[model samples]
Structures are given as structure tokens and as C-alpha cells.
Target: MNRLRAVPKQRLLTSALLLAIASPALAQVAEPVSPSEATELDAVMVTGIRGSLTSSMNLKRDAQGVVDGIVAEDIGKFPDTNLAESLQRISGVSIDRSQGEGSKVTVRDVGPDFNLVLLNGRQMPASSIEATNASNSRAFDFANLASESISGVEVFKTSRAATATGGIGATINIKTARPLESEPLANVGMKAVHDSSVDNLPKPMQGGKWTGEMSGIFSTKTDDGRFGIALSGSYQERDFGYNEAAVGGGWYAFPGGEGPLANADPAVNATNPPGPGDIYSIPQNLIYAINGVSRQRTNGQATLQWAPTDTITATLDYTYAENRIQQRRHELSTWFNQAASQTSWTDGPIAAP
Candidate 1:
């Protein structure tokens, strides 16, 4: 017989003794647990946004330097369209917009040229093309990498022993999924994107439309979990644009008795009757510019891993990516002759026409 015991307190003893007296006696024989019952036991697996956030918190806690990170909800499930867009979520990070899309990042108010980007611990070069020449800019274009097939990204805001020497502002490390660490799996995804602002463009300036993206990943390992292979690929297309009205030619300031507004003396146009010494001016040019941009990106990676012992492992991987862009610009502007009939002006200390 087993006894339920508690400290011998005056009030506690009454409840313990009553409970023990009311309960049934236990069996002395032990029973075996069935295999079916053991197999039916519940198991918990972390996944989705909660899992990603947990992983990110862990990465920050474990990484060196002032590190911040973003982890995927699952394989190939980064929510942003590209790397720069996702990076903007971190504090002290901002992006330079190119054709209405995030192109490069500025960390801690430092320019992108001084920042370094790494792929699986190897520094990657930055390159882009122009009409007349191929300029080798140090700024990495984050728009080139498809957001799919990502495992995580870590940003080091300060230098440490492991930090590469050149990136004074920050060092960015992009991580991809590895097969050996994962269970066998296959996944495919597709997307369609549309930019409503394209419709706001003038008839001749509006050609952008919906685009499509496709991506997939596959991973497998031998029964022993020592040898594994992972393959991933993504193709994405996008149409984007920027439209604005501005004085791109720059403003021209006129003196008291100069320029078209100064020459024209209309009593109704002036805030008050214009004196000969009053200063006024007209716009250099009223211009509206419409810009359209299109981009196509493709990415592919293959990884193979072999681990013969718990202490040592060998891995080989190959990654390839390509980005192509097409752009066009159209402008409509206004200019007036200095003659009083062609233009009317208001006289004041400021320029107006």
C-alpha cells in the first residue's frame, strides 16, 4: 500500500487524510504499454510565421556582432518580392528605390557601395549594364535575387572578427536551405503581380501589365541521413514604373528688373501694381516624365552533402542567377516666349507666372 503524505500541519492534514481515505486502492501488478498507444502519442513541430519568428530570435541571440535576422516560414516562403524589400523591415536600414522598387540598401545611414553582401560565406560581386558602357558599381542590387528558395538572412550592423574588412556599414549574409539538415520534401509555388499605378500613366506611357513567377524546390537524403542532395530554381517577371511632374531642368532665379515676368506689367495679374524695382520670375520648364521598367530574374542552385562521421562533413554547391531589365522614359514639358502676350505674370518678391 502507498500512502499520500504531506507536512503535518493542523489544517492541511484533514484534507490529505480525507482524499486518501476516499480514493480506491492501486493494483500491485504492472501492465505493459501497447505499441499502438506509443505510436499514437502526439508530437509537436514548429512551423509557419511563428516558427520563423522564433528562429529569428534564436539567430540574433546566437550570432556575433550586432546582428539582426529574418528567417523563412518554410522552405522557399520568404514573404517579400525580393531581398531589399524584406531587409527594409530591420531598424537602421533603408533602401534606395529604383523604378519604384527597392534596389539597394543603406544601413546605419551608410551608402550601399561600402556594404558587402555574402552568399554562404563567400563575397559576391556587383555588376550592371548601361547603354554606352558596363559600369562596375560596388552597390549590390538586391532586386536580382528571387525571394524564393531562401532559408534566412543575417545582417551584421557592426564589425567583429568574422566581419569582412570592406563593409564598414554592415555585412549581409544570405542563407539557403541545405538537404542534410532537412527531411525529404518537394514544393512548388506560383504568383501573379499587378501594379495599379501603371494605369495612371498617359496613354502612350502605359504599357506595364501583370507578370508571373514560378519556383520549386526538392530535397532528399539516404536512409542513413549521411548523403543528401537539394535542388531549387526560380523564375520571376515584373513590370514597374515611376511617373512625376517636375522642373528637371532646374530653377532659374531672376533679378528685380529681369526675366519675362519683370517685363510684363499687368495690373490684374500682380498682387499689387508692379513697381520697376519689384522682382518676379517664371518657371524654367514645367515637365512631366513617365518611366517604365521591366525586369526578369532567374535563379538556380544545387547542393550535395556527405557526412562520414559526426565530427567531419564535406559539401559542394553551385548557384547561378541572372537579371535583365528594360526601361523607357517619356517627357512632356512647357516653355513660354518672353513676350507679354504669350505669358502673364504676377509681380512680387517671389517668382510666379
Candidate 2:
């Protein structure tokens, strides 16, 4: 009976210990760090803030973004230079180029429309949609947005700052020089350029070559008053050339076929080719053509800035562009006879036996 009573006491103690273990509040608690330790962490955060501020200020002072910037003086030194070519130096920038040297700049693999390219902080309106036609592609002409008109260009890579809020891919800002508040003076500039294709293919116009540009800047203060007016304008033209080859192949449907090859065969005449309303073989190498494209563009811009006082300013700007693109293409093909000995080439002589 005494042993049985001891057992009951032991069981009671065990149950109480288990209950305490399962209770969350009774578990061990960790102590918070002391004031000195917390202060040490604050120091690290302050250092990081200072570093970031320094970087931001540097970017602003240089008239650049964290991503990139290009100055007009730099562009003046290169050959066949243009706005798109200048912007290509920035990291992550690419070009949506055609056969011609002319192209639109792309940022970080994004489409040209995704970017917001501004002239003096204002959006430039598009002149056309077809991009290749000068009359149609005039809205974003590189010539109208002259490299000379730009004092500098800034490419914003990220939207970390308030100024970079609207653009997602990137913002290209073209800065223009400010008119002087003091005595004004006139400045004049002229430029000429020539470009020839490296392909060296015989062209109707000898591989497309051309040159043209005119520019002037005038500023003056009233002889007796503080009022001043300034005007600047530029005009340029270029001839672009390109050669392109295109290859295309598509499937052909046959009568009572499960898959595309159910009744497919290389047996057909050119008179009734495989196309809509017909069932026939699809020749892989049916047509081969080389096309030559040439274009001439005339672009110009005018800007006027007025600063009556040190803090008051006004500006007006305009752009005009025209392009004419012409294309000439010839398709050549060879047809082999059933005997394999008779061969005929389009635009070429065939020996008849």
C-alpha cells in the first residue's frame, strides 16, 4: 500500500512537468540587445545613406543619370554621327536597325516606342507610322533632332528618383543651351558629310552618296533695354542605302491527307502553283530575290529661347522632316527539267540542246 502511494506521487509530479513544457509562455525567452549594440547598427545605416547621397549628387552635377550621358562636343568628333549612334555607347542600349544606317535607339532591349525621348524636356511628336518612308518616318527623324542642337543627353536607367518617374524603359533627355541674360552675341555653324556603302554592289546611283547641312544662331539685346531675343535653326539631308535578302517557306495542304505530308510530292507546274484553291507540292526553294532600298531624308529644326531676367525664361521649338524611300528588287530562279540536263535560269541564258 505504501509503494502504491509513492507511485501516485511520482505520476502527479510527471504530469505537472509535462504541462509546463507544453505551455508556450513558460518557454525560455531571449533577451533584447543593449543600447550600445543598437547604436552600432544605426551607424551602419547612416554610412549607407551618405554614400547614396553622394552618388546622386554626382549624377546630377554631371548633367547625367546613373545610367549614361553624352555631350555634343563628343559627337562632333566622330564620322557619320547622329543621335542614335551617340546613344548607342551607353550600356544596355541597342538599335532597331534596318538595312540602311539609320535606325531608332532601343533601351535595355525594349521597343523604340517604350522609350520617352525628349527635346528640351518636351515630348517629340511622331510624323508617321511606317518608319521607313520619310514622309511617314518624319516624326522621329534623327536629323531634325540634330546632335549640334543638343548640349548634352541624359539616359535614365532606373526610376529611383522623382524626375525619372514616368518612364519605365528609360528617359532620354536632350538638353539645350540657355540664352545669356547679359549682352547677347550671334553664332554661326556649318557642317557637311558624305556616306558610302561598304557593300560596294553596283547601284543605279553608285551606292547612294549625299551631303547637306546649314545652321545659324542669332541673339541680341536691345541697345538701350534689357529685353533680348535669340533664334537658331539647322537643316540637313542624307542618302541611305541597303541591300536585303528574304527567305520564306510555308506548309501545303493535300487532298485526303492526315498530316501535311499525306499526299505531298515535288510534282507540279508553275502555271498552277500550290496556293489557295489548289492542292499541290510546296517547293522549298521556289523563289530567291535580292532587293535594294535607297532613301533620301531632309530634316530641320528651329529653336528660340528668351530670358528677360536671370530667373525668367521662355522657349519655342519646331522640327520638320521629309524622306523618300525607293525600292528595286529582282527575283531569279532556276528550273530543272525531268532529264536533269535542261536547266533554265530567270534573267539568265539557258543553253538549248
Candidate 3:
């Protein structure tokens, strides 16, 4: 028996400093400090790739179950273009690429549909045309969510008591920025996207221009720390094309290298004859198709938090993403319904034409 795992299987000290002086005659109990009398320590903010990696390492060490994560170094600043690309950095995770971009993810050996995705601990609904079952749409498309507004992503490989249910393979939680956690700031970004695949197509079918991407985020918190708000949105466009030439119905094999469409005779049909136990196969159809595809993805999120007390907080957030696709296809193909005048093949164990 063998086990499968290649990842090299690679702490809280709380000490209360009590400044108390005891006298022999009378004993005075140390009074707890009130909120007004307590000293407020300055908050330490860490940013950059190293800082984010440290944060991820700390989370994994402190978590109760098998877990991994990626944290953003700063607000609206993630290393990858989208969430799906970031997830691929984790061990035991793979993604399905669409048009040179990541779409969905597979955790461990399980498929995408069974993996659960959550936004700030709330269940996120996903739908796809690739779904094998119509009854449920459980696979979330990571490409739909841009990385600008995201703060961090956590992947739990094992089921835990507090997390959401129905993640047979793994549960992924997407954490966004909150008013209190994020400092008061406003940021905007612009990017130019150019895909050479579109330009490589026929001049008539090509989208000859480049696309654009824009994102902005604003976060604010009240001076009293009682109320906070965050708003972020991203818009991205992609112009790409897919050209494929392949066999559609696959090849059908014939025993003894003879079928209704082909004969085993080397003199008339092929250069080599088929042995008694040899086999041959021929393609049913030859297909060549070209498609010009355009895609636009929009993502927006608004979060509001009210922290009436330091220990108790109420958070309300709404996240929305829309993906639109337009495509034009031109295809040229041949179906093997009519026999050709002559087809030839070289010498081999089995004949082919």
C-alpha cells in the first residue's frame, strides 16, 4: 500500500504582566483596567509580498485543519490577475484554462463541481455550461472574481465544524476588504490587455484592437470606529480567438484491417497488407474550425460594518459578478460518407489510409 502526498510535511504564549505591590498589613487586589484607562497600542501594518507570505504561513500554522491561503500585500494589489491564478499556487490544486485564462479549479483529485466556494463565510452560487448535472450548479468560476477587491483566499482541504457544508473535496473561502480592517484610502488602476492570438487569425475574423481594464476601491471608517464602509469594482475585457483542427468522431478500429469503408488488399487498397490478427482504424470526420471570442467580466462589492462594541460586530456585504461572452465561428470539415477514388498508405503491421 502507498500513500499520495508530495508537499514536504513541513503557538500562543499569553503572559499577563501584573504590576502589583503587596504589603504585610493589608492586601489590595489589583483592579482591572477600564477601557478609558487602558493604553492603546499603535497598530503595526505590514505590506508587500514577503509580508503576505508571512501572514499565509502563520494562518496555516494556527489553523485546526488542513489549510492553505494567499494574502494580498496591500489593498487592491494581488500578484495574479484573478483569483483562479492565485489558487493554482497552492499544493494539490489545479485549474482549467479558458482562452489563456484560468476559469475553474480542481482541488486534490476531485472535480470542480464538488468544491464549495464562499464569500466572507456565506455560500456563493455558481453555474456553468460545463456542468454534467443540471440539478445543481455548485462550481464557482474563479475568473469571474477579479483580484483587485480581494484581500485573501483560504482553502480548507478537510471539513470542519464551523465552515459551510457540501464541499466534498474542499472548501474555499474568499475574504474581501472590510471598512475597519482596511485603512482609509482610495485607489484606482488601469491596464491595457493585448492578446496576440486574436491578431493571428484571418484579417476578416480578427479583432484588431486591444482591450482595457479598470479597477477602483475606496474604504473609510468613522473616527469613533463605530461604522465603516468599503466599495470596490473592476471591469475587464478580453478579445481572443480559438482555432482547432481535429478528428470529431474519433477513429474506428476494424479487426483484421477490413471494414465496409476499407479493404485489406495491399495491391489495390494500401501499400501493406494487414496480418490475420492485425487491426486498422480510420477517422470518421476531419474538422477545422476558427472562432473569434469576446468576453467582458464585471465585479463589484459593497461592504458595511458596524462595530458597536470592540468584541461584537455586525457586517453586511453584497458581491456581484457578471460574465458575458460573444463568439463567431467559421468551420470547414469533411464527413467520410462518400468513398474517395484512391487513398494510399505506407507499409505497416496494419493498413491505414
Candidate 4:
């Protein structure tokens, strides 16, 4: 009976060891994992005017040279219609509006001739048909480019090896938006403008009419975010005018007691001399001028970007801009001449067509 009891005890000891070995495997398969213990992820999203301001500040801070920049507030919007007008917000920058519109930029007291303008790191063709003196130097016509097609504008105040040579005042670099910069972005805008001067003018001037503008932008990227494309277009028309008055031609001055002509027979002579004084002449011409201007502008841009890997990027961009301007001037003049006596005068008002 004692031998039988020892065998039973040995079997119990073996079973206990087996149970201990299997307990760990069962616990591993039955326990559940909490979702909070998973790996962490990161995301970034920016939009609106605040986003544009932040992006512009970042660009200025990270630039290798002294630079100022302006970023678009949205898909197809800039601060102003004329690029030069927007640039005036920068320090030490000024603009010239000879044609009643901001057409040239002057940086740090330096004229536009010394400043260079670049379109995507390349020199753009010059258009000066409406420029003052028809000057086509290094300056660019800001009116030709529509603000909606641009993504950003950078003004380089200091030179760098990577930058193009030739700007003493500043180098302007205009950049177009890329599709990868945003997620399936699209925008459209239209505006109708009325000019009081043009609308209130008489019948003939009424032809100037009202003005309008239309602009749009579209951007998309591939599912993998490796290839992208952006397209933008804008059309604008404006009618404006200027009114001016001035005095024209020669002047006649005499000492005390001396008349304007010094003679009465319509010719200068000693016997018929009146008096010597500086107050007799009323013989001169007065002029007035009315100028009217009309302009039409169209701008478009297309950009394609390809990134096969995270470390490399390739881009192709194309831009087109056209501006047509029409101008007309009408002048009216009046002449005053000496008649009977040296102190006498005649008046004739003449209109020029």
C-alpha cells in the first residue's frame, strides 16, 4: 500500500510541471492590446491669409541673401491688381505711374533701369510701347502681368552667386504655383469696375465704357504625390483718362514806362514807343489737353512638377502675357496778340482736332 501511494504522488508532480509550462502560451494568445499604445503620427495643414503671412516670413528668414517676398493669400488672389503697387509696401521701394497706373518700380531710390526683373529665374522679354520715352531697359511693365497667375514674388536686395547678375537696386523673381503645393486646389474670381471719369464723360468719351476682369486657377497631384500640374489664366480690361491745363510759348518783358510792343503800327519803332514798363504784354498762348487711355491684358501660366524620390525634383513651367493699349489726346489753345496801340491786345481761342 505505501509503494502504490508513492507512484500516485510522482504522477501528480509531473502534471503540475506540464500545467506551469502551458500557462504562459495561453496568456499570450488571450490578452488584447490597447489602441493608444500604437505608434504616433504627424500631420500639417495651413490656409488663408495667416498661412500666406507665415509662409512669406519663413521664406524671408531662410533666404541666403537679403530678400523680401509676398505670397498669395489664396489660390488665385494677390494683394493688388498691379505688382508694383504691392511692392510699394516694402521698405525703401517706390513706384512710377506715368500712364495713370503703376507701371515701374524703383527700389531704394534706384530707378527701374538699374533694377532687373526675372520670370522664374530667366529674363523676360521687354515691352515699352507705353513706357515713358519708350524706354525698354532693364525695367519691366508690371501692368502686363496679371496678379492672379503668380504664386509669390521675391525681391533680392543683395546679390548671390546663384542669382542672376545685373540688378543694382534689386532683382525681382516671380514664381508660379505648383500643383504639389496644395491638395486639389481650384479658384475662380470675376469683377466689374466702373470709373467715374469714363462713365460721366460726354457722348464721344462715353465709348470708353466700363471695365472688368476674370481669373482662375486649378491644381492637382497624383495619388502618390510624385507628379503634379497647375494651370492659371486671367483677363482684364481698363478704361481711364487724364485732364491737364498749361501755358505755352514765348514771353515779352519791358522796363518801367516801356510798352509790350513799343510801337503802334504792329511793328517795333522808336517814334511810336509807348512807355517803359514790364506790365503791358498780354500776347501768349494758353492750352488745355484731354487724354484718354484704354488697356487690355491677358496672362496665363502652366507648371508641371515630377518627383521620383524624396531627394530630387524636376519642374517645367511656361508663361504667356499680352497687353494692348490705346491712347488719344485732344488739345484746345487760345492766343492773345497786340492790336491798335502798344497797350492794346486781341484774343483768339482755337480748338485743335
Candidate 5:
């Protein structure tokens, strides 16, 4: 399985040394640190990038940050494969995960809604579902952003930055890679991934899942040297299941002269009226709950770009995503009274009719 694990104590110290020397935090671009100052003998290093197959394949034992910015490949070395997952490695960052998966990112224990997410330096859209069960507000669905097309990610963890003044927690800026130098070729590519497990749910529950994605890009320059056109599209699909636990029925009433009796006297009979010996009680109903949840999701997108002049560019893009969930739930209650038949004046076994 493609999974990320927490950094071990030994690896933390070792990887820190390597990362401190190579990470962008100490690099010359965003933050400058000379080799002398980064000469830590013990430090653990982990990559921040997760989706660059080419970059990851070409990584050297000591290679670090790139010239452009902080790529996911730099953070990919740790166990995280998602934005929130990778961000958790950063100090003071927390997450409200779902089913052990990265669902939302929180900084310094602050709620996710307090944070902001940006795509290509612009606000995308917020999810209508609340981050918690309390209010109508919702969390930003970071999963909607395409990680494969991402070139780099910038995080403004501090509140003093002008660009991050919109939100209190932090601001996440996701950037897509543009043409390296105005390539004229018709670039087309596709990728697919599948995941399966025996027991995705609790005991007596088992299932499997698969997901795939395809995307392409086409660009060309007009002969007049003043115009250009580009087109792109992408599609994706996924399937998964869910499970839960519950207990039912807290109280119950028993037979009595009027309603119910507190204690069993065993000394008096029915002629005694609503006194002692009129009631016997224990946990009334022993019930068990069974619930099942399954869902399927699909998303498609198309984009167009045209540049009539060197400094003027116009672009149009549209995306559609749909998800369906099929769920089945049931509950059963069973309680046996070892003596539901026999009856006696003094609470003794009745005659064997």
C-alpha cells in the first residue's frame, strides 16, 4: 500500500540534518542560509513533494529544494501523499482527519475554516458542509485540487504577511506548472491507480476499491507570431465504503400494582397491593446495531486559453464533479426471560401445567 508513517525518533534526528541543509526553509531563494550555518551533524530530512515521478526518480541522496519554489517532491519522502498529510509534518500544524485519511488541515489547533486555500493565486470555492457537526459552515475540500498538475505550494504560516491577512490560521497557495519555455508540441498524458483492502470496515465487514485519472494538454503558436491557442481536459473516478458502532434502549418498565416497584420483597403477594415483591428489574433490552455505507465519485474538467498579444491572455475553464452514496442500516433487539411462564403467590415457580 502507498501509505505514510510517522517519523521514527532515530530517523527524525538523521533526516533533520539532511533536510536542514537541503530544505527551502534554509535555502537561498525563500530564506538564505550559508553552508557554514547549516553544518548540523545530526538532523533528519524528508521531501515535501509527493506527485513528481520524474523528479522523485532523479532524486540524489543529498539533492534538496529547486530554484522555482517548494515542490511536493521535497515533502513526499515522509509518509504523507496529500497536502494536509504533508503539512502535518510542519511544526504547529494539526489536522481533523477522516477515517485515518487527511480530510482537513488545521494550524496551531485552529479550525480549518479559519484557514484559506488558493489555486493559481485565486480563491477556488468552499465546501457547503461544515468542518464540524455544530454549525452550517463547511470545510474547504482540498481533495478537489489536482495534485499531479501542481508545480509548487507556498504556505504563509504567520499572520504578519499582507497576503495572508484574509484568514487567521494560515494561507495555502497552490500553483500549477506552466510550459517550461513555450513548447510547441501537443502534450498528451494519462495515469491510473488502484487500491484494495480485505477489512476496510470493522469485524464482519470487508471490501475493496479502485480509482483512475486521465488528462491532456494541447498548445500551438500562430504563424503571425502574435497569437496562441491551448486546450486541456481531465477525468477521474473512485469507490469506497464506511462503517460505525452503536448501542440501544436505556430503560424499561415492569409489571406492578399501579406502575413499577423499586425492590423485590418476596415476603408479600399480589393481595398486598402496590407494595414490595411487586417488581423485578434488570437491563431491559440488549440490542446490536449494523450499518453500512458506500459511495462512488466522478469528476471532469475542460479548459481553453488564448493569447492575442505578448502581454494579453484570456482563459476559460469548467469543471464538474458528482458523487453518489448507497447506504444500508439495521438494528435488532433480543432479550430472553428465563422464567416468563411460571408464576407463584410468593414469587415461586408455578405449577407444571
Candidate 6:
């Protein structure tokens, strides 16, 4: 009979082993993935202006109250040298310039005195060269802070109980960079600025000069990724000039209640009789002034961070800033006095203290 020969045991075993090794089911099983590898795959890195815009949008979307923000384009790089100038880009925000440089910010219809400024999360001291007024009393001088030392700025229009309570306008929070947020980094920048307003004046009146600014940032982390440090500093100097015309002294009303006088009232023939006037109010004093200002700013910041465990972190931060402003004013003033029956003029130089 054509009976099949007995299958060899070794051949049968070898065929079963080959089938197991080549099976699709065996090949479909995946190896376990490590947490670090998975995190890397999901991480997204962004940079430059677009990154700043993206970050700002995210902050707005996630904030609990009405808020706006500006994020730095990169390490030590902000949208503008003046923090007030940068805030002007936000809606409902306005800025006042000092000698053509942004120095103060106003939010909505609220004045500067109604706004509060915080460094990091704590209230910082306020300062200004202006005499105390509705706008300068509680206003922080943005010109004293350096853009290079800031990582972002946030303005909170609506407040919660946890929020700081000084501002009726808005709360401005300045954020600084941290070392553990990135890998080793270094950035240095220099800028030269010229002001045409003062530079184009006559030789004796020209107070404008080429202004220079320098800024730098350095950051690094430990090999174990548990400790980090960051340092930033900036310096700037500027010279500028401004001119003003003003009228002082009370206006004079014509006799017989005819009206105010533009010049000495002829009808009042008293030796002086309200100086010079026609039918409109008379200007008793005329003043012209040219002012020169020189200003310098120095700023610095340092931060250290440590994470001893996955759930524990500690940080230490320090900041310092100094500003100096010197002003000189030249004035030519004319005075008309009916009481003294004399017209006088004076010219002199005034130095600001």
C-alpha cells in the first residue's frame, strides 16, 4: 500500500517552531515605552515673535479674569525698550512719554495713579521725576525697569480675592525668566538710538545725542537637571531736550464789564490799568523755556532654582534697578503789571534738583 512514511519527530518540532517565530500575532506585540521618551515625543518647542504671540494667546485663554499679556520674543528680547511703550500695544492701554520716551502707562480711562505695578508677584516701590499729581502720586516709573530683565508682562483688568488690591485701573505683573525653564543659554544685545527732536535744534540748544543701551542674559542648569541659575543685566543712557511756552498771571477784565481784554484797556487810563488789552482778556505774562535732560538706567536680576524631588521645588530671586535724571532749563520770561505800572523781562537758567 502507498502508506505515507512516518513523519520524523524532529521535523515536526522544527515546523512548529518556525510557525511560532513567523506568526503575525507575535510580531504585533509592542515593547514598553519609557516615560522620558514619551514626554519628549509630546513636547512642543516655539521661538521668536510667533512664539510670543502664541504664548500670549494661551495666557489669555487660560486666565481666570480679564487679562492681556506680552511675551518676550527670546531670552533678553522684548518688543520695546520701554515697558510703557510695550504696554501700549494692548487694547485700552495708553502711555505718556517723558522727553519722547515712554515713562508711564494709563489703562482705559483710569489714570496712572489708579494702576498698580508688581515685580514678579510682589508690589514694587514707585518713583518718578515729576512733582506729585493725580497721575504721578502712585504711578510706577516704567522707565526705571529694563526690558531685557523681563520675560513677560501681564495686565489684569478683573480681580479675584487672591489678586493684589491696589489698582482701580489694572494690576500689572512683570514676570522674570527662570533657569530651569530651558537649557544652557546666553544672549547679548546692543542698541543705538537718535532723537531728531533735540538733535536738529540749533548748536547751543541741541541737547540730543546718540543714546546707547546694552543688555545680557546667561542661564545654565546642573548635570542632574535638579538645579539652575539665571542672571540678567542692562544699562542705558540718553540725552534729550524739550521746549515749552506758557502764560502766567491773572487775566484782566475791561472796565464797565464790557468784556475781557486782549491788550491794555485804553479806557482804563490809570497809569497801568490792566496792562495792554483790547476787548478780550489780557495776557499779563509770557514765558518761553527750553529744557535739557540727561537720564541713565541700570538694572539687574538673578534667580536660582532647585528641585530635590519630583514634587518639591525651591527658588530664590533678587532684582535691583537704579535711575538718574539731570535737567537744565533756560527761560526767557516777560511780565506786564498794572499794579506796579511797569513791564519787565527776565532771562535765566534753572537747574532741576
Best by TM-score: 3
Candidate 5 local lDDT, residue 314: 67
lDDT string for model 5 (1-353, tens) is 22334456568889989987788655456656678888667765542333443443444222332211245442112233455675666667777765345667787677888888776566656752213234444456655444444445656665443353565777767655443224444645565556453245454543335556665555556565444444444455544444444332222233434322334455534342322333433334466655444444444444445667678766665555454445444566776442323333233222110
Clashes of 3: 0
TM-score of each predicted structure versus truth: 0.71, 0.55, 0.74, 0.71, 0.48, 0.73
lDDT of 2 by residue, 93-153 (tens): 8765556444677788876767777777777665432355445332254534555445567
* Candidate 6: segments with Cα more than 4 A from true spot: 1-44, 131-136, 200-208, 249-284, 338-353
Candidate 3, residues 286-345: lDDT per residue as tens digits?
989998987888999999999999999999999889877777789999988525445655
C-alpha lDDT score of every prediction, in listed order: 0.78, 0.54, 0.81, 0.78, 0.50, 0.79
Q: Distance (Å) between predicted and true CA of 275, model 4?
A: 24
Q: Using lDDT as the measure, name the better of candidate 3 and candidate 6.
A: 3
Q: Residue by residue across 21-122, what tens digits does model 6's lDDT show?
A: 789767578677877777545677878899989999999999998999999988688888888999999999999987777988999989988999998888
- lDDT for model 6: 0.79
Listed per model in order, the count of residue pairs whose N, CA or C atoms clash below 3 Å is 0, 2, 0, 9, 27, 12
Query: Which candidate has the highest lDDT of all?
Result: 3
Candidate 4 ranges with C-alpha deviation above 4 Å: 1-44, 129-135, 246-287, 333-353
Ranked by lDDT, the better of candidates 5 and 6 is 6
Poorest stretch of ten by lDDT in candidate 6: 344-353
Collision pairs in model 3: none
Across 1-353, the per-residue lDDT of candidate 4 in tens digits comes to 99988998999999999999999999889968789888888877777889999999999999997999999887677888888899898888899886667888999999988888998899876677465465546678788888887888999999988878999999999877888777788889999877766653445654445689899999999999999999999898888777878875443444433333443454533332323333333436788888777778888999999999998989999898888878777889987564533332333232111
Superposition TM-score, candidate 6 onto the true structure:
0.73
lDDT measured at residue 49 in model 2 versus the true structure, 0 to 100: 37
Better of 2 and 4 by lDDT: 4
